[model samples]
Target chain A: MLKLDKVNSFYGRSHALHDLSLSIPKGQITAIVGRNGTGKTTLLKTIMGLTVKSTGAIDLDGTDLSAQPTFRRARAGIAYVPQGRQIIPDFTVRENILMGGFASTSGRQVPALVGALFPYLTENMERPGGLLSGGQQQQLAIARALAANPQILLLDEPTEGIQPNIVEDIQNIIIRLNRDEGLSIVLVEQNVAFARRAGHHFAMLEKGRAVAAGPIDSLTDELIHQHIAV
Target chain B: MLDTIFIGLSVGSVLLLVALGLAITYGAMGVINMAHGEMVMLGAYTTVLASIHLGIGLLGAIPIAFMVTALVGYAIERLIVSRLYGRLLDTLLATWGVAILLQQAVRLSLGLAFFGITIAGLGTGLQNVRVPAYLSGVISIGGEQVSLYRAFIILVTILLTLLTWFIMYRTAIGAQVRAIMRNPDMAAACGIDVKRVNALTFAYGSGLAGVAGVMMSGFKTVFPDMGTPMVVDGFLVVVTGGVGSLMGTVLSAGLLGQINGLTASVSNDIIARAVIFAVVVTIIIWKPSGLFSYKGR
Candidate 1:
């Protein structure tokens, strides 16, 4: 569904991503698991057009997305949930959810559809985003991406700040979205066990390049302990 | 004595309008926007020029002035302000340069002579009060007499304040604006077009400033360096009121206006300015972040 060929992204003189290539199959949760500062976020930024300088090809459904801005990339059916689940705190739950509709391809309201993805959001639609606790904000953040109805959802640490119970809720939502909705997902995470649950495929990034890539089954517990357990 | 409060409110209302837009551009956008005061100058000068040169009525001149100044703001942002945006000191200096250019441009074209705008049938005095004399005329609250215009200005300020509050807090665009302000990266990730919203916010903020300029020029004399005088206070109001908070901006402007009006009656106007500037400095040195935050930005 998505392909990156010989992609290199830079932040000033510091090279954040090397000549890395990644591809995702349809209807599966693809996990790019790495320690912090391992170019995982940079990869997502490059795909989302948030990177300042990038040299490579990013194609989604055969349409080149390397030159588009972040918003443009989103309109092209790529939804991203950034690190820390950055919600617009001053905005009400409904407003934050409505913000997701900005990438609505049809230019029509989809409240019922969004409510289906995260019912709690629909329930507390009038409350300010800041008023929600950490876990609830994470749900709202994910629901916001779902509201966009993208072909692929790129989530960066959706479970980082939430409690264990809410983490399970997020995991279940991810499962439902992928299994039932057939939405492609590129999840960047630091937790191995968390990544192992929904991740059907895994790639380990070190320094700035992908050092390992294969199906989730190939990433044995020993390999996970050796590289990602830290 | 009651008339003094009225004077303060009229002055405060103009300050509120001027400061309200500054709250959005500098406060919400983090653009520094030193050119904001200059935009107000552009509007006032545009209004005067429209009335004098084109003989346009005030009604026609209002929207025309708004648009032209908005375009001026848009062009400045696109050509100059946008480039200097990421760098704080650079944006400050660049916008100041734009302000100087605008001021000098007006001086070069129109010269130093002041121009008068005669409102069709409206005179300088408040011949008609919206409320009855007992209600509209200020009673002594604090050893000061407020006049009808000043009282009316306070009421108008409240109304516009509420309107802006509703637009910013309850509406969709308001959410977008606050979203962009809080977390541009998150907002971008969520599919909100940061640049487009930013441009609109800049234009809208400066446009409101333009309206303030139009209203101010009607009350005061229109001169080339008119905006320069208040540019510092504009900064101070935002700082003291807490950066980007609409309520903060209004409160600060009102406090500053009353202090300035009351002080100028007794001491030099500079004393009034010094008092307000002192408060702003103290606030920043103490709590750099303003009272209200568009958090997560």
Candidate 2:
């Protein structure tokens, strides 16, 4: 389980995430839903220790990760697939995927899971990542994260900007990873219907604070209208 | 003409060594390390001291100089450069201060001047390293006579540059370095220790500069201020070639060195310097990013 308790994150003086607390249970999908600029991304960055400064405790499993650096936090089994699918443009697809293996306890290698799920990436392993389409780039990003052999996956809008046909494919893969691989996932998504479909638990954020959180069933349309609808 | 061209090649080789480290550090870390030239000064000094104290020859002093400068570079990264990662101007200013400190440290013989004590091979005085008997004389190549030491400098630079290429492209550490050079935050997110890689990169670059110093000490009189002009020359190569492109550095160094050599051969060293500066300014105005800048996606 990954837990954040009263975390306040800052970016060189501008407060990004206020006193926020959230828990992501093991072997479950927790969707973080909120309006634009509501700190959904900051929460994920805070967990990854990417923020300039953050106060409060971040516990991953039994390991206290608040004081740990980003690389250490990743080594401890939290893999982040950030927004924009920030793959190295010049790096080959194989190299891009193997990059996540730096955090893997097993060392650097393309995991069998990546080859199984991302066949296109496996086929184009020699091609530069920048040559891929947006959907393909998203797949490469996920494949890269999976190579880490992470216990928890933090995805920030994985389906955003992807083609409509590939969107469902990506969403289904996210569900399968949670159900079949039994991996804990913290999903920051804007598609409310898809969030309700995939998330076992939900957290509604507002101005960097979690105003509503509970089982996915408790995420009422009223709550969505009140906090997320713009 | 042939002798002048050979001289240009040798000069270009030394410039390549000096610019290589500056290219990597400035390209990867965005640090304008004004103290980079100090590493060269330290390397030349290391050769002088090694000869005087340990009775070590020029060849023997090479590795020692590398190690000494690398350690100093690591310390600079850990203490000062590391703190000023994103602040480019601050890093330039801080490293310039470090450059002065290093120059003064060498000039004063590590503060021994205050106590009226002077080390034999140190302090504010010019020094020279004797070339080995084998490298002291010229050899016939084709129909031209080439200085054996100059040939040795060219050969060593070629070998070191190849070694650098292998390390950057064929090694795991190299991949991490390239990754950091492209996107530091993403590299960290992928679990690459950006700080560790950066420190190592800085040390390696300093080591190369030290080797350049040793090469310079063989041919020129070494003094406290010898490396100051070298820093400017090295940056000229880096900027004209392109910040991060190794091939660019190599080619531009050769081009500029040839320009300097050919012009100096025709006119004077002062005129050659002016011509080189004019060419660099033209290149900058023409292609501001560099000759072979990496294309962003």
Candidate 3:
């Protein structure tokens, strides 16, 4: 399990996240839903140690990760797919996927899971990542994350700008990852209905603070209207 | 004309060695390493020391000089450059300070006077390296006269450039370095150790500069201020060729060297220098992103 206790995150003293605490359970999907600029992204970056500064405890499994650098955090089995899918444009698709293998303790190689899930990436192994469509890029990002062989996946709006048809395909992939692969996932999502459908637990954030958090059944429409609805 | 072209090629080769280090460090880390030329100065001094003390020839000083400069580069990166990663101006200033310290250290024989022990052939003076008997004279090449040492310089540069290309394009460390060059944060996120790679790269670049120094020692006067002008010439090549583009650096060095050589033969050194500067300014104004800027996703 990954846990954040009273974490306060800052971006050069702007104070993006204030006294936030969360427990993301193992082998389940936890959706973080909130309005725009509500620190959903900040939470993810804080976990990755990408923020300007942060205070408090970030424990992955039994170890404290607060002092660890980003690369070490990756080796600790937390793979992040950032908002913009920051894959190297000049790197080939195969190279992009293999990049994540750097974090794996076992050594570097594209996992068999990547080839099984996205045959398109394997087929266009020599093609530059920039040539791929948005939907394809999303697939590449997930494939890249999977190469790390991580226990938990942190996805920040994986389908935000993807096409409608590809969105359903991505949604199914997330479910399969959580259920079949038994991987824990923290998904920061905008689509409330999809969040309710896929997530077992939910956290509602407001102005950088969690306003409501519990099982998906406890996420009432009233709570959504109070915190998320703009 | 052939001799002039050969001279230009040899001159361009030395410039290529100097600029390659600056290109990689500046392009990858966004650092303006003003002390880069000091690595060259150190390399030339290494040759002088090795020849006088160890009784070795210029060829033997090559690897020794490379190792010495690379270690110094590593220390500089770890001590100063590493902390100032994103601060371009601060790095420029700090490295410039380092350049002065290095120059003065060599000039003063490392201030070893405090220990009351003096070493031979070391303190405060101009030094010259003797070319071996084989590389001392002009050689006949297809009815044209060519300086053997100049030819040696060109060959050494070509071999080193090819080695650099192989390292960057064919090795795993090269991939990691390139990945960091493009996106340091993302590279770190992917679990590549950006800091380690950067330090190694800085050392390698310094090593190349040291080799350039050795080359210069053979043909030019070696002194405390010798590296100051080399830094200027190196940056000129980097800017005109485009920052971070290896091919751009190679081609531009050749172009500028030819321009300098041809102009100097017809006119004067001052006029040739003025012409080279004018051409660089024109290139900068014309293509600000450089001749071959990398396109990102």
Candidate 4:
């Protein structure tokens, strides 16, 4: 389990996440839902230790990660698929995937699971990542995260800008990653229907604070209207 | 004419050495290292000290100078640059301050005067490195007389350049550096230790500058002020070449070196410098990004 207790994250002088606490249980999907500019991305970045400054406790399993750097945090088994799928454009698909392998305890190698899940990436291993379509790029991002051999995956809006058909595909992949593979996931999602379908738990955020959180069954439509609606 | 071109190639080789360090440091870290020239100065001083104390010649000083400057670079990164990451202007000012401190430190003999310890080769004076007997000779190829030392310099540069290329393109560490160069955040997220790699990269670049100093000590007067101008020249080459491109640095160093050589051959040294400055200005106005700029981060 990954836990954040009373975490306050900052970007330079601007406070992005304020006194936020969260817990990601093992082998389950927890959807973080909120409107635009509501600290959803900030929460993910805070978890990854990418913010300018942060105060409070971040624990992965039994180990305290607040003092650790980003790479160490990654090596401790948290893999991030950031917004915009920030893969290296010039690097080949193989290279992009291997980048995540640097964080893996097993060392740098394309996991067998990547080949099984992303046959298109496997087939065109030498092609530059920028050449891939949006759907393909999303797949590549997931494949890259998988290469880290991470126990916990933090996916920030994984289906934000993809085509409708590819969105369903990615959604299924996320569900499979959690349910079938038994990997824990923290998903920052905009689509409420998809979140309700896939997530076992939910956190509703507002203005850098978690306004509501609990099991998916308790994620009422009224809570969504109060916090997530524009 | 052929001799003049050879001279140009030699001059370009020196520029390449100086610029290579700037290119990597500036490219990878977005830092404008003003003390890089001091690294060259330290390298020359290492040559002087090694010859006097260790009885080692210029060839032997190459590795020693590299190590000395590399260690200094590592210290600078750990103590200063590491803390100032993402603040470009602040780094520029901080490193410039470091350059002045280094210059004064050497002038004061590292403050050894308080202890009354005096070193012969380390005072504030102009020094020259001695060339071995064989290297001082000239070789005739195709009835053209070529200075063997110049040829050796060119040969060394070519070999080093090739080695740098191989490391950057073929090695795993090199891949990490390139990945960092493109996108530092993504690189870090991928589990690469950006700070560790950056420190090593800084040391390697500074080490290259030290090698350049050793080469310069053979032909130019070695003094505290010698490195001041070298930093400007190195930055010029880096800017004219693309900021982070190894290939760009190599090609631009060659181009600018040739311009200086060919112009100096035809006219005077001052005029040659002026012409080179004009050419650089023209190039910058034409392509602000550089000749072989990489489009993305």
Best by lDDT: 2
lDDT of each: 0.76, 0.93, 0.91, 0.92
lDDT tens string, model 2, B130-236? 98898889888998998889989999999999999999888889889888888888889889999999999999999999999999999999899888999999999
| Model 4 per-residue lDDT tens digits across residues B128-208 | 889888788889879999889999899888988988888888888889899999989888888999999999999999999
The DockQ values of the predictions, listed in order, are 0.56, 0.83, 0.77, 0.70
lDDT for each residue of candidate 4 in A1-230, tens digit (9 for 90 to 100): 99999999999899988899999999999999999998999898888889889999999998999988999988999999999999888899999999999899998999999888888999999999989988899999999999999999999999988988889888999999998899999999999999999999999999899999999999999898877775
Superior by lDDT: candidate 1 or candidate 4 = 4
Candidate 4 clashes between residue pairs 3 or more apart in a chain or in different chains: B182-B297
lDDT tens per residue, model 2, A1-230: 88899999999989988889888999999999999999999999999999999999999888899999999999999999999999989899988998888999998999998878888998999999999999999999999999899999999999999999999999999999999999999999999999999999999999889999999999999999889786
Residue ranges of candidate 4 with Cα displaced over 4 Å:
B114-116
The candidate that achieves the highest DockQ relative to the unseen native structure? 2
Judged by DockQ cut-offs, the docking class of candidate 2 is high
Quote each prediction's TM-score.
0.87, 0.98, 0.97, 0.98
Best by TM-score: 2
CA deviation > 4 Å runs, candidate 3: B114-118
Off by over 4 Å in 2: none
Candidate that beats the other on DockQ, 1 or 2, i.e. the better one: 2
B223 in model 2: Cα distance from truth in Å?
A: 0.3
